[model samples]
Target: MLIDRTHRPWLIFSGAGLAVAAIGYVMYSAMVVGGPRGGSAVGLTYGIIGYAFMLFAGLIGLRKKYPIVRVGRATTWMRGHLWLGLLSFPLILFHAAFSLGAGSLTRALMVLFIVVIISGIFGAVLQHFLPRLLTERVQLETVYEQIDSVRGQLLEEAEKLVADLRSALEGDLSFAEEKQRAMAASAGTVGGLTFASGLGASEFTSQIVADFFDQQLRPFLLHSGGHHCALADKGQASGMFSQLRVQLPRNFWPKLADLESLCDEKRGLDRQRRMHHVLHGWLFVHIPISYALLLLAAVHAVFALRY
Candidate 1:
């Protein structure tokens, strides 16, 4: 029943895989259930496959969000984890079912298998659901550098304007200039003022351009070009501003007022990485803990035998 695990894939894969496994188990159970020779062997096989598959799922989750390894090629290994878990479920149940009135060690081993299965199932649900939800909430957001790219462009344009402002206020015009010339230079012009105003354009600042800066900045400047210099202090930023605005959505505009608020952008990636760590890390917890449980179960068995 090893069909192509694509094209209505999950349905076919799970169904066929389960069918094949069920058939194999039925054949084995019927062939040997009455015999005493194979019971221990079946239990041991169940314990090995169950532990191995639980370990594999944890390993796959551990690799999540690794920087250099983007995809992790996790799809099939994950599917294997699912199929193997389903397969192991029956194996462990059968192992337990046939061992009625077994020793304390046997009961402890069964309890351990049950605990591992429940924990692994809980982890599977969390890994599947939380990531998709996180991605949707953060769809509008992006990396800080993308927005920083905008602020960088704006600051470059602002610096150029400041240089132009400096020449008019300080280079040609000075405190010696007459009051009339100073007033005229301050009057504001399209190509900029020629008047020798002492307090010339060098006073240009972000506050001056603040009002004219709209969502469609260049158009607002072009349409209001006549009064652009006179009405607002410095006028709108260049097409550079438009480029950055277009990179983001309309809702991003209000958020655009400050880029630091874009922290939600990285949340999805972080959540996946975190869950991966938690799931995988449990094995580090589980291996040592399982050894201890096995040891304790063995001790209990030895005491029961001695008694």
Candidate 2:
């Protein structure tokens, strides 16, 4: 929340320029007079106002992100951002003035405005609601990664499977007898292991039938009760994302995919990175299309000039 009050001069100056633009737009009706066939004076006014709001929001973001170079405090910048987001839509729509069909440039700008507005709203949702959810999910993700890593360690330990099988075979262990022993020796331990310590019980033994080999004939292993049996139960209980948890949901988590690198370096990160990405990315949509609209506008303008 640092602002150099000393830079008040610049802030006042820029703000004064904004005031001038706003006042001029509001008072200057004749400037908006256009061709009889296309566009509306009132709609253009609304569009300009909305554009002003959008521009201010962009400025606020830029100032906050680069506070050292900013002339406003974080709180003030945030206030500006919030107010602009709330008010700008109506301002720009005034520019549109409900006229969509009469001009190519108007239609193009309308599409751009709609896209920008929707993307901005999504950004707001990310800023407000998404951070808390992401925090809980991050903790949950930590747990899942830890589980996977612990499962890996258990696999390392389970490497003793073949050697243990050989020794048991030498004792002439029958498949039924081995099942009895493995079950009795470890009734609740799944795969003769546990999920605790990332290695307490494994889910591997219960999923399929065990094979009995000859020569070094050993008794087949039996299923031990495991927590993974409740995976479906756990997901259903969460109520967060039943649809996404399918076939390794924890590993291929969705939120992380949107803003992974940013989340690592910052807290309360949420989908800001994703929002910024889309905002800037959508510029390609806006800029090039604006050109087409301008081209058409120019065609209309030239046709009018000759007549």
Question: Could you give the C-alpha RMSD of every candidate to the true structure, in order shown?
Answer: 13.2, 13.6
lDDT of candidate 1 vs native?
0.46
Candidate 2's residue-wise lDDT over 1-307, tens digit each?
1234643654565566556545654565446555222235544445455555556666664675677895867766665655565466555444444355465755665675566666555555555654455555444233322443443433333333433322232222242234434543333223332222232222232111022111111110111112232221333323323332342124223322222222222211223333334435644554454344435544544653465
- Native-to-model Cα distance after best TM-score fit, residue 41 in candidate 1, in Å: 5.8
Model 1 spans with C-alpha error above 4 angstroms: 1-74, 98-101, 139-307
lDDT of 2 at 202: 25
126, model 2: CA deviation in Å?
3.8
Error of 1 at 182 (Å): 13
TM-scores for all candidates? 0.39, 0.38
Least accurate 10 contiguous residues by lDDT in model 1: 259-268
Writing each residue's lDDT as its tens digit, candidate 1 over 199-219 gives 332333322333234333322
After the best TM-score superposition of candidate 1, give how far the Cα of residue 195 lies from its true spot, in angstroms.
23
